[model samples]
Structures are given as C-alpha cells and as structure tokens.
Target: MTYIAEQERYDKMTYNRSGKSGLRLPAISLGLWHNFGGINVLENQRAMARRAFDLGITHFDLANNYGPPPGSAEENFGTLLKQDLAPYRDELIISTKAGYYMWPGPYGEWGSKKNLVASLNQSLTRMGLDYVDIFYHHRPDPNTPLEETMSALDLIVRQGKALYVGLSNYSAEQTREASRILKSLGTPCLIHQPSYSMLNRWIEDGLQDVLDEEGIGSIAFSPLAGGMLTDRYLNGIAPDSRAAGPSVFMKPEQVTEERLAKVRKLDELAKSRGQKMSQLALAWVLRGGRVTSALIGASKVSQIEDAVGALAALEFTGEELALIEGILQG
Candidate 1:
C-alpha cells in the first residue's frame, strides 16, 4: 500500500529554528530510544512513524546502541524508510548518534575519532542513509581528548556524512569547549540533546545558558522523565509499564511517594488546562521556546498523537508558572 502523507500535516505543527541555524525542527521530535526495536512489532512501529509524519514531525532520532542487542533500532528504521518513508526522505531530519558501548572493545565506545567514525559508519549502514541531517556525539568521553571528539564530528561533516553536528549529554563547560572547537573547525554545533524534564532539571542549572551563549539549539530527551510525568503511574505502577519492566531507564523504586505527590498535583494542573499529564510536561519543556524541540519516545500511535496535541496550548500564565514552581519546589 502506498503511504500518502496528510496534505495538512504542516498546517498545525510549529517549526522552530535550531538556535541561529537555518534548519527548523518540529516542536516535538520522535526518539527511537524505546520500542521500534527488533524485538517490537514492526507494524506498530510503522504505524507510529506514519502517524508522526502525518502530524508534521519531521525529525526521527536514533543512536548506535538504542536496541537491546544494539544497532537494531536503526535497522528497523531502515526497513521503515524503505517501505513507507522513502519518498519523503528529503523532507525529513533524520539523526543518529554514537558514543555508547556498541561493540566489545575500547574503540567500540567513547568519543575517540576511531569510535565515532566507525560507529557512524555502522549507523549509516544500519539506517541506509548516506548522510544524516545531524550527527551527535552521544556523550562526552572522559578518557578521550575533547578536540579529538569534536574533530571527529567536524570530519564527519566534512565528509558529507552529516549535514550538521551536535553534542549530547555534554555539560555546560563541555558544551562551550566543544562548540569553540567545532567553530574553529568551521562547523558550528547546531544543537544539543540533554536529559531534561520537570523531574530532571539539571540542564537548567547551567546548560541552557551555555547553549544560548553558543547560539546552539537544544532538544530535550526524556521530557516525560521515563513516564514519571504521565498518567501511567498515577494509580501506582502498572504491570505493563516501563517502571515495572526490567529496563534500567526507569525503576519501580524511583516512583517514591514524594514523587507521586508532585505528579498528582501536576496532573491536577494539567486537567485544569484540559490537557493530559504527558501533554503538560511537553508543553512545559517547550515553554518560552527556550528548548528547540522535545524528543519523545512513544510505544503507540496514540502517544504520538497526544504529544503533537501539546502544541495546542503551549502558553502558560504567570500564575500557572508560579504554581508549577511551588509544586516542584515542594
């Protein structure tokens, strides 16, 4: 069956510039961190991909080690691209990263040039892409020289393997340094991906300022905090939920009574705004347009729809903002 995208796909969704870059990304981008793996149903993955694009989500994020067996998510997305999204390839902002434990060896992980180049080669092969829109260093390598890593990114761009380069999980100081290096290399850092949510606000401490100073846009991963900000755990963890599962991303014990109290209060606020808990979290992350995009992972097509719906009401009143601060401070 031929997949015809919704003609009105770009009508409702908002696209924001990535910092000072000419490239614009949907406010909500899809992350293939969970699900969309080899272990999951390909049909469901296909549905999610189609629904997301139909909703004007042009960005699809993946990493070298996203799957359980590693590299499977890219392989699955490759299948999806060929079958459903190949025609729209030029219209998409496909991205993938390297910097995690992929293969067994010292060179398999980290930000070394050898690792980054090899990892992206593998990622490109797995995704069947000649050049990703953006290629990111998954995390700062403690052992590797920062220049070495940034140089690898510059080399990737020079080689036309990636249109732009970015940094992920890099601290404020690290980001500043890398941005300087990349700038010297004539390849400015386009964006930064970091773990950010109401529950996890480390980026606010300093990273946001650095991004602003560097003219680099940001995409927040885990905007829902591993489903902690959603209705999934409102009545306690469900057996089918990620917290109940063996995934290290989210643990059942992390759902403390204290956290639930805050979540409940936030949920009340979301209801008053006629939004779901997930939608509210996403809106909050994208508030004031400080963050370029909120990267969300969905297990179902409905989740993609719900995320896109967050754009309907992204504004927050001063009082609402104060109330949220009070709730979070408690």
Candidate 2:
C-alpha cells in the first residue's frame, strides 16, 4: 500500500532555525540510532517512520555505524525510503554521519578526506538517496588536523553530496576551531550534535556557549538519557530495556537505587504539572530555545507518539524549574 503523508503534518511541530543557516528542523526529530537495525522487523520500522512523519517530524537522523553490523540501519532506511517516503523526499530532513569505526582498516573511519567522502558515497548508495540534507563528522579525530576535517566537509557541500555540514561529539574548542576553518573555506558549519540530558549536563560546561556565540544550532542526542528520563524505569529496569540489553553504552548498574529515587521524585513533579516524566525531560531540553530538536529513539509507534506529546506541554514556570533543579541536586 502507498503511504500518504497527513495533510496537516506541518501544523503541529515547532520548527526552529538551524543556527544562522536557512534550514529549520522540528522541535522533536526521530533518530534511527537504534531499533531500525538488521535485528528489528522491517515492517515495524516502516510503521514508526510513517507515524513520525504523520505527526510532523520532518527530520530523521542516522549514521554510518547505526546498525549492529554497521550500515544495516541505512539499508533498512533505504527500503523505507523506496517504499514509503520517496514522494515526500523534499518535505523531510534526512541526515547521516561518519567518523566512527565503520570498517576494519584505518581509512574506514576517522576524519580523512578519503574516509569521509568514500563513507558518504556508500551511505548514499545504501540509503538510495542522491544527497542528504545534513552530513556530519560523527566524532572528533584526534589524529587528524582540524583543517583537514573541516576542508573535507566544505568539499562535500561543494560536491553537492550534502547540503550542510555538522559536527558531533565535538568539544567547545574543537567546534570553535572547526567553524573558523569552515567559514574561511566559504562554507559555514551549520550545527553541532551532542549528548545532552538532565542527567548529562556536559554541554553546559562550555559547548553550549560556543554554539550560541558561533550561531550554530544544536540537536541533543539521548535527550531522554537513553530512556532513563521516562517512566519506563520508575519501577525497575525491564528485561527488554536498553539498560538490560547487550549495550556497551547503557549498563544495568547505572540504574541504581539513587538514580531511581531521583527519577521517582521527578516523576512526581511531572504528575503534579499534568505531564509525564518523559515529556518534562524533553521539554526541559528545548526550554530555552537553545536546542533545535530533541532527537529521540523508539522501537514502537507508541513511543514516537509519546515523545511527540511532549510538545503540548513545553512551557516551564520558575517554580517548576526550581523544583526540577532541587530534584536533580538531591
């Protein structure tokens, strides 16, 4: 069956500027970092994608190493694109990144011109797209010179493989340097992707300041702290949860009693405000309008609906903000 996008899709989401660029992304974007892998059912992934677009989530974030076997997520997404999203391509913002360990050899990863270029070509092939809206360097390459990496990004935009370029997992200093080089090359760096959540406030240390000063947009990954901010773990970690899975990033031990206590307190605060814990957490990230989007991952369509519901209650009062801070401090 052909998938027709909802006519009222644009009415719901709040689209914000991607830095000083002309691009605008939704307040909440869908991330294919998990569950769109080879292990997951293709039909289920299709349903999630449709529901997201139907709900006005125009951006779908992906990376070269997103799947369990690397590249499988793009393969799966390619199928979805061919089947459902081809007609609505121009209405969506599709982005992907490279720079992680994708293949065995050294050229398979990092910030080399050869790696970034070649990896994008493979990504395009797998995703069945002529070009991606945004292409990113997945992480900082300590061995590669900033000039080299930034130059490659400029080249990508000039070559028409990507419309705009972004940096992920980059520090304040690194983002500043990279933006400088890209600006010198006549291609401004548009955005930065970072791990940001109530539990992980590393962005506040310096990164956020750099973004604001440089006029670069920020999209927060793990905005729900890898599902920890939600009510899913208010009781305990379900066996099927990310913390219980074979994830190297999420661990069972991290779901300690202390964390659960904090989550419960926050959950209580959310209930008092007529919102869910997840909704409170998502809105908190976008509270100040600093972040352009909260990139969320989901396995089921219900989770997508749940995250999108956050937009309805994005406002936060001084009292609620103080209570949230108190809970975090406790």
Best by lDDT: 1
Off by over 4 Å in 1: none
* Residue pairs in candidate 1 whose N, alpha carbon or C atoms collide under 3 angstroms: none
lDDT (10s digit) by residue, model 1, range 137-226: 999998899999999999999999999999999999999999999999999999999999999999999999999999999999999999
State the RMSD for candidate 2: 0.9
Error of 1 at 189 (Å): 0.3
- lDDT score at residue 82, model 1, on the 0-100 scale: 94
Once fitted onto the true fold, the runs of candidate 2 whose alpha carbons sit more than 4 angstroms away are none
- lDDT digits (tens) for residues 259-288 of candidate 2: 899999999988987889999899999998
| TM per candidate | 0.99, 0.98
